[model samples]
Target: MSPFPFLSLLNWAKTQGRHSLPWRAYFHLSIKDLGYHIWLSEILLQQTQVERVIGYYDHILEHFPTIESLANASYEEFFPYYQGLGYYSRARNMLETAKIVTEEYGGIFPNNADELIKLPGVGPYTAAAIRAFVYDEPLLSFDTNLEKIFSRYYHGNRFRKLTQKEKTLLEKDFRDTGISGREMNAAFMDFGSMVSLNIKPSDDNKWKKNTKDYPLSDCLWLKTHGTLEIREKKKKTVFPTKDASIIVVLHENHRIYYSSTEGEYQSFLLPPTENDIRHAIQDFFRSKFNLELSVRPIHDKYFENDRPFVVCNAQVQKGDTLFAKYRKENGFFVENT
Candidate 1:
């Protein structure tokens, strides 16, 4: 959303960013492989770590090769492939979603967000990711990195942050439709994850502060202390926050998977689970340490395979519509909200 074509810069650097993981090769393949790979990768990511996902990714790719093969696969047969991935639900969802794709969508993943979100595991981030990389649907994806970007951009602009009406301007920056939105959102996220600095050595550091790019780093303050302190060293720089308070936030789409880093913004395909929150407790050590944890936007698979997802907020309920997510508005990622 910068006046500049930041996406081009990040995409050019995608091969070298913090997200420059080996598993992303799955993205370069055909859409069929891309979707399947993304699905398999997300399932695995939800339950396991990145390094472990690499081999598991290859194994899943080798065995299933396509959605149909996976749809036809049984959980008894599929569970072993995810042995290292501790999250059982992720695997179950993979199988269920694959089957759903086979039975409902004719064995091909739907290129649209509505149909994609209907899949067992596909949430806002995952569905948008599928649309971006495979279908080129242009839906914007929000993740850890993006949350930082938006939070920084909207640092003091709480009018936009607190309600839906003000956030719509953000859509002009990364609307959900086409490759441009994907690139903008992806780049925004990557910028935060990679380029942004993680000054916090541990999550327990309650005081962290970071500079944002809204109006060229005009925003540099702590959620705890407010913007009264801190020096403006430069624009778009991530610093340390050992005792500062206030973290970044990202927009959560209605019906999209959501779980943010306390005051920071991050999105997930599946809603974050209690177990996931239990595990995330450890990450807090670092969050508190960050003077400003660098939340750069670089599009790479942060949530894939079997990592846990965001804890579902008040937004989701039975018979929820895709658009329903838009209405619930956590005042987080629903940029429109």
Candidate 2:
């Protein structure tokens, strides 16, 4: 009944939606079940590929099993279960949130935006997702995929956040269609994943050939726009690059000194002045391990995050008091004999 073609979208979803996904079974689940299953999956699926999350999802469920179980464990206890999933901070946040949900809220995830967003690692988009999926709230979870779909299909290829008035009107229109918010959101997810791919026009030659049979292709606003100039121009964000440095200290004992500080051993910010690099490294070693180091800059490496790191090799100049101190602190030798 909505002007936004919900019937067509629902029909498309029935045929093309990822119906068999494990987390899609939230229809009759209680809040606890939804929290355990859907919330965990959504968190894992953040910036992670669906394929990559599937095994971890099952593994997490096998270990935690419930919100209460997850809550009972500290981050240290939960680390092994969540190890391979690179973002240790997310795991920590998940543990903190689980504990809050279990101990404070009696294991019931908050259904409203205000309460939901207050949870650790739960932002506005995540809160929207939980509200729509768990509480059947009439709202859209505007992630990159949905943003692409809505921008092309409705906003004339202009990608921008919808105004509050716009969202309310759209929600009202969507509610009139009698489709539950969960199903509608799922359809958008499928349509975005299947049809509104992020392929650029120049790069779409192969995609065009592959997706020629897709029914959703007919509804793509890009088809009506014709020229690439009219399509949404992706905005690229330029991040200011910073230089960092790390020193790998090797001892004659064949053991390497390591520190968990900065989440990497011997990592520190590269000083702006070339002369300061050695002194900075020395200061860090003195302060952290109470050891003086003979430092030599090795080679620079750039990480995926676009930050450059100057790798350095260091030899222990002094630290006779080190063996006693290092044993009590986080910094340790990798293979201490």
Candidate 3:
């Protein structure tokens, strides 16, 4: 095993870890509610920032209030709360898991990893998190942060998964250090996120130079090895931009309209099109919102992909009940332009 100071890591976590996160706040609640909250928080946190998740987590807890409430809500009812949080699948999976838990487990969350993994969206990392945080079980939750820590400390670089041997060494280190699993996992996450960040080469070196006050200063690859070799950065992909259009739908009283589409990044704007701008806007409104809109070009510009796009503004037809109903049902909210 690498001669890293695992005990130092645990000591750092005791004073510096993010112990006040939303999920951790729920630990003092009822056991049934504790599992549900932790599960929801873990799923929401995947590939998302903690700052962004705080509001969403609070809103979801306020609306759903319990696992049964979330399970009983329809997709339409639930999708609103999850709007703008990319990864729609996570929300859908959470609904499915809630239903399963309510029906199969009598509303009590399963304590073991095997049973927890059967729930939708509960991957290995999330399952371990639930066991560790909610049940206080001694299990490792290997997230991206921990992955970076282990990969760099063990291999002196990243872009790889931990080998079985590395996993064993880590487990043994944790055990021998007398650190509980939850504390160890939390320490790795905090240390990796706050202290051992993988930045651009210049910033990485600067961060290394200031490591005297950082947690587990000697264990960092840059400190131990005096240098770090990063994997080659991936080349940026260039997409040939065809003609595209962004529709700005405006309702009465200065209300601006927006909708979300599924993709790698959740887009508030409609699809990019190569057809005639007017026809494309008409078709998009008809197909997606089932309403025909007359749009006028506001601006024409080229975006990052080097494609020409027209930003068109349209007004909601007077007394259009269908448009109003669609807006309400789809949870469309207005933003001031």
Candidate 4:
């Protein structure tokens, strides 16, 4: 794939009598607003309408004011900022992610893609966007909007299915445009919006408005080719996307849970009602595993109702047997062991 000529596209837009919008003002009021801009825009733009994000963007700036402030803010503080934004989880995730960035990463915007993605609610696209904007990482943020622009530019078909190969090739092509990383980010988004607004999609138009080389619903060469391949594998229903991976959590109760279903390990709130806690316990232990699991709370009392669990390095007496310790205070027995 040839370079996307992103700088040329920018020049084309400029010569056509459009000047680059001040990305800073649109995104940030000041450097203090940088983190606010990134975090706010990332959440607001996720699966949300652009028209709706505009006002909420301003509202968030009015509230948090700074990245450090956002980091220090409680979930309650951030939740109010998310009133009109449908996803309540984004606000909470951002609050948590911001704190981790502040506490662990020393308040510097993370440049590592893996580290950024590990933050709450961050994914490939969001992580790439943050790295590009903050560190000029030259990474492409491939989202549905950018995908559409590529579909119009190359597919010629009414509907284009973007294969993983195409996405990889497109990123490679756009990177060579030598445009600023931010421009590459903005151009495809603007181009996609412009294509929809200025030109109507139809077969009668003869691909004039669209620049696709492929015949509609026909095989043709594409600019980018993704290396992703499909393989047959067993599929099962799970709370979120189902993969082979599994997470197990042993609660303080005698119950066990597969962590995949729970939102997060710490997301589980304590101080639940007896019924709620019991229900959670029941749910975990209810799973298909045959081996027994139990939580043995560490205790100080010798005659405690719990069996005597060996803690630290304590040698059992000569007469001590598994049977005797099993009934001792301060321990709980597990059938698995």
Candidate 5:
């Protein structure tokens, strides 16, 4: 609709994009190393902010620098570095994928979309990202950031998913520009993140003050409609309230053991219920951590994630070596003396 706006966005991204991010440097890395780094970054960035992911990404690479190291380590071995990152399943999928790559493909990632998609936890978006970033294939990563940029640029702030016909037309426009896939996709992603922001800047913001024309001035949407349109806010999904019981088991040594929820933020959870809350909590510990504890509810308080839960504390009533060993070794057991 607006001739893709490729050149303008690319030029903007060049001076202002996120260049310091560790994963963006592909020049010094071999193809195998490049794939591993990009894959890890993409998975960690899923539903997570860039600021939050940087530390974890570095910590993970520090421990497991190669695919072989990651594949050789157990989830428990990797969990400490990955803990508090939330989305435990992403780590699990990453571990599975690492093993697959190590054992099946000799520690090298597949270059094509078809083969890359077959790996664990890899979907179209991730596959596309790997191809574009690592292999420099001429493909769009097509995540929400780019979606927002395109929606506003094409539809004038009527933020909606682009249709296939629109994407095809844009791709054709992109190809006509003869930009490299690496440069174009990187520019689009950075523009969406840094420039095409969700919150509109204040009128006197430096960006507007410095330039005679506001950003995207040449785009058809902005040219035809002088100002951004305000779309009615979509209602947030209301999850059904669920009651949960959380146990904090403390050892005489001042260390505590806790159970973590999977998939969602290590945050609030709507965990499935069993016959009763006590049994559910007990069953979870027994099945998952191999620890049997006599849980007695001490108080009712909302846990860190803001879910209403029964806070129960268990003394070292039983000894589970698996927990004890890891707690000591990985500092899983935490509390000051």
Candidate 6:
């Protein structure tokens, strides 16, 4: 509402902000190098916490080192590093984008937003980010953080989409501010994350006090709406808990039988049995893999899920041809525990 809240936000960020992030450290590098780092860091940060991604970013840089290296690496080689990162599709897209950049752009990233958006996994926000941070382009990257700050400052509905006129006004404001788009973006993000947070009902007053201390002159929301209302937290739906016996069928040659299920735990798991788990394992092996194999229970553990599952491990009979065949074809190898 200050026509430029970014001035105060940027000033605040200089003293207290997330400036030490690994991606920000690459700002001094050449555009090509900076683009690669920013692209990788942005993709990795998606749906993941900054704390979780920092080590992963460093490790990925160690492995890939460059766009060409990332492009050349096989899924088998890359996926292991990305194992605990949850969203495998993002990693896949990153690999694909790296290949596109290397093959089409000759290892140089596209500087402009339009061309950058054409690359795999690079959306509007990501493209704007790359353009602003790496190419110094004056594009507004409307991430969730910026959206909240703008909505609060301008008395706009946080949940509603911005109209064309609103968008034009925001663009014009940015143009008139004279602050670097990169710094402005960072300032808004830091302000939203640190100060004017989306907090619970009871915490609204505390946040309102903090906002008043910051003192934005034209904040229509503070003037009109008064104290920021507490955002109602969504009710978490409780799922029915279920118990299952998970089988970790290990062969004599140290190859473990793993299943490729598309769920939280992507491995061979079975329901709990009243009788012997070994007999159940044998039945599963004979039915699913078409193999006659003996099995014995190794250990049992519980896995937390929508429906909590009880996982039980079992060792399979050695000399099963199907196990070897599946392992060879699918590369479904896990350490025999």
Give per-model TM-scores. Answer: 0.53, 0.66, 0.69, 0.55, 0.68, 0.67
Q: Scored by CA lDDT, what does every candidate get?
A: 0.50, 0.68, 0.69, 0.51, 0.69, 0.68
Model 2 segments more than 4 A misplaced: 156-165, 199-220, 225-337
Instruction: Tell me the tens digit of each residue's lDDT in model 2 across 1-337.
Output: 1256666788878887899888898767788789668789889988888888988998888988889999899765787777666544577789989999888889988888899899998988888888888888878787777766655555545354556676676667877777878888989887777766544455568556645654544444557442332545699764322345443544332244544352334433444334566667777778987876656545444554655555655555456533311121354434333
- Estimate the lDDT of model 1: 0.50
- Give model 4 RMSD, 1 decimal: 14.8
Best by TM-score: 3
- Model 5 spans > 4 angstroms off: 199-215, 220-228, 233-337
CA shift of 126, model 5, Å: 0.7
Q: Write the per-residue lDDT of candidate 1 for residues 1-337, one digit (tens) a residue.
A: 2332344545545554545544456446776666776666666765356668888888887888888999898866886676645544566678889888778877667888787887887787877777665565545565544545455444532122323433454554445322364445445544554555434323334333342322223333233233432345676633222212222221222244333333333543322323433223324424443221112222232223434222222222112222212223445444223
Model 6 Cα lDDT, one tens digit per residue, 197-293: 4444355676466666564556655554444543568998642223454545443333435444422224466776666565676787778877544
lDDT of 4: 0.51
Candidate RMSDs in Å, in order, are 16.3, 10.6, 10.4, 14.8, 11.1, 10.0
TM-score of 6: 0.67
lDDT by residue (tens digit), candidate 4, 1-337: 4444556556544443213432334453443345447656776789886667877777777877666788888755676566645445566677887788778877666678888789888898988887666555666788766665555456533246679987788777666655677655655555555533223223336344353422222212122221121124789543221111112233322232222132232212222223333333334444533222322221121212432211111111112122211111245433322
Decreasing TM-score order of the candidates: 3, 5, 6, 2, 4, 1
Tens-place lDDT digits, model 5, residues 39-149? 999889888888999999999999999989999998669978886665455777889999999998888888888988999789889998988888888788887777776
